[model samples]
Target chain A: EAEVAQSPRYKITEKSQAVAFWCDPISGHATLYWYRQILGQGPELLVQFQDESVVDDSQLPKDRFSAERLKGVDSTLKIQPAELGDSAMYLCASRIVAQSNEQFFGPGTRLTVL
Target chain B: SQQGEEDPQALSIQEGENATMNCSYKTSINNLQWYRQNSGRGLVHLILIRSNEREKHSGRLRVTLDTSKKSSSLLITASRAADTASYFCATDPRGGSYIPTFGRGTSLIVHP
Candidate 1:
């Protein structure tokens, strides 16, 4: 089965530094989502993309976080001047637009800020 | 929080035993989905029970949705060691938006 792909499975950085994570959704999937999962907590939506356009980013911290799916395929999420509280797992998910139901997730990038 | 709550945050059972977890939400939902996640990995889709449906089953997994009560339950019959994982219930609320709110999840340990 095709799976969502994420890079930098593990990342450790100092607070105030910039960090970015990448994700590649399954072929033909048009909807991509970014989520943050803190320790011992469920995943929380950060942003969602439909093709190359953003759908919902109500939960995203716009001041420090930004995500883009410019090509309507792969996506990138960035956090500038990361803070200690930003340490968490960043997960990417994708689903087909036409069918638009269940989401498939990537292994996720585990971020640790010191 | 729109995320909802799941009961019995943690459960342990022997192999071949059954495991059941219940989820309760605060809002009207279009559908409820169950997902499983092994430690340090991504979540895998399990089953989805629509609000219009009362019960659904796939293999050993059985899910029931009570929209009137705004609660859902997932039952795993004759579980195995491999069944050990964190089970989460995600709700897609009514309206056009399809973003799902997820609860903390129930951790299950099926010992062999």
Candidate 2:
């Protein structure tokens, strides 16, 4: 089965540095989402995209965090001047827009800011 | 705080036994969903029971929803060692098209 793809399964960085994560959703999927998961917690939605337009991003920190799906197929999430609290698992999910139901997730990029 | 709160922070059961976990939410919901996560990896969507449905089953997994009480339960029967994982309940509140809100989840350990 085709799966959502995420790069750099693990990342380690120092505080105040910048970090970027990439995700490639399943082919033909039109909706994509970015989520952050703290330890011992469920994933929290940071941003969501429908095609190339941002659908919902109320929870995203506009100050230091930004996400974009320029081509509407793949996406990138960037955190500028990361903080210790930014260390967490960043997960990517995608679903078909037409069908618009169940979502599939990628393995996720685990970030550690020391 | 999360809207959905799952019962039994952790549960240990033997193979062939049934694993039951319940979830309660604070507000009205459009649908309740169950997900599974192994270790620290991403979650896998298991089943989604809409508000109108009372019960749903897929294979050995059975889910019951009580909208009046704002509670739901997930039952995995004749489980296997591979069934061990963290289970979570998520709720999509009424009058929303965004993503669902999730609880902390139940950590189930199915020993062989």
Candidate 3:
């Protein structure tokens, strides 16, 4: 079974610093998603990519957060001047074109901003 | 805005017992999916029920969908300690966007 891969399973950083997380989706997957999950809450969509093109990003905080899937295979999510409230699990998911609603998820990167 | 909302935010039960969690959504959905997440980890897709389907089962997991009531339920039979995790329900709206909306989730603790 092919799986989505994520790097730096855990990250700790200062509040004002910058941080980045990477994700590589399952091969042949055309759609990718990035979500932020706060403790005790469901995951919230931050960005969605379709073949290297952004499909939705209304929920993303553009002022401080940014995400890109240049090759439509792997993606990167960055947060500059991170805030304490930004500490949470950053999840990456991918969906093949045929699978209408099912998504494959990576292990996720747990970000902790002090 | 959240599309799904789970009931009984938390549940605790012993091994061998059955656990049930309910979810309600606001809009017409094409399909509903259930996912599980361990502490500090990513989510894993468990089951999916289409709007036209009423019930589906896989191993120890069972899911039922009620499109008329706009609600769904997940049941885990003969639960074990390893089943302890947070379960969430996700809905894909009927439109073409295909973006999924998730509920807050139900935390289940299966004690051995």
Candidate 4:
């Protein structure tokens, strides 16, 4: 079974520093999602992309967070001047078009800010 | 905003026992899905129940959806220690977009 791929499974950085995470969705998946999960809470959507265009990003903190899926296959999420509250698991998921609503998730990148 | 809220923030059970978790949502949905996440890991899709369907089963997992009540339940039968994890319920609202909103998960610990 093809799976979503994520890099930097663990990241530790100081506050006010910049950090970035990468994700590669399964081949042929058109919809990609970025989510942030706080400890003990379910994941929240930060952004959604259809191909190379963003579909929704209302919940994303635009001032500090930005995500892009340049080629529509892989994506990158960056945070400038990370804050302590920004520490959480950054998850990437992808869904197959015309298929069931089930999403394939990658082992998330855990970001810890000090 | 999160649309689903799961009941019983935490649960503990012995091996071979059945565990059940419930989720209630505030809006109409196209489908409700169950996911499991182990400590320090990503979530794994468990099962999905559609609005039109009442029940679904996969392996040792069973899910039921009550559209009228906007609620769903996930049951794991004969659960083992490996089943210890946080279980979350995600809903795909019946709107134009496919964005899924998740609820605070129920932490389940199946003691061996």
Alpha carbon lDDT at B5, candidate 1: 81
- What lDDT would candidate 1 get against the real structure? 0.92
Tens-digit per-residue lDDT, B1-112, candidate 3 = 7889998799999999999999999899999999999998889999999999999999999999999999999999999999999999999888767778899999999999
What TM-score, over all chains together, does every model reach? 0.96, 0.95, 0.97, 0.97
Give the whole-model CA lDDT for all candidates, comma-separated: 0.92, 0.91, 0.93, 0.93
Q: Across residues A7-105, which tens digit of lDDT does each residue of candidate 1 receive?
A: 999999999999999999999999999999998788999998999999999999999999999999999999998999999999999989722478899
Q: What is the lDDT of residue B112 in candidate 3?
A: 100
Lowest summed-lDDT stretch of 10 residues in model 1 chain A?
Answer: A94-103
Clash count per candidate: 0, 0, 0, 0
Cα lDDT tens digits, model 2, A1-114, are 999999889999999999999999999999998999998888888998999999888999989999999999999999998999999999998989722467789999999999
Candidate 4: tens digits of C-alpha lDDT, residues B1-112: 7888998899999999999999999988888999999998999999988888999999999999999889999999999999999999999888767678999999999999
Residue B7 displacement in candidate 4 (angstroms)? 1.1
For all the candidates, what are their Cα RMSDs to the real structure?
1.3, 1.5, 1.1, 1.1
Candidate 2: tens digits of C-alpha lDDT, residues B38-70 = 998989999999989999999999999999999
In order of the candidates, what TM-score does chain B achieve? 0.96, 0.96, 0.98, 0.97
Candidate 4: segments with Cα more than 4 A from true spot: none
Worst-scoring 10-residue span by lDDT in model 3 chain B: B92-101
Alpha-carbon deviation at A41 in model 3, angstroms: 0.5
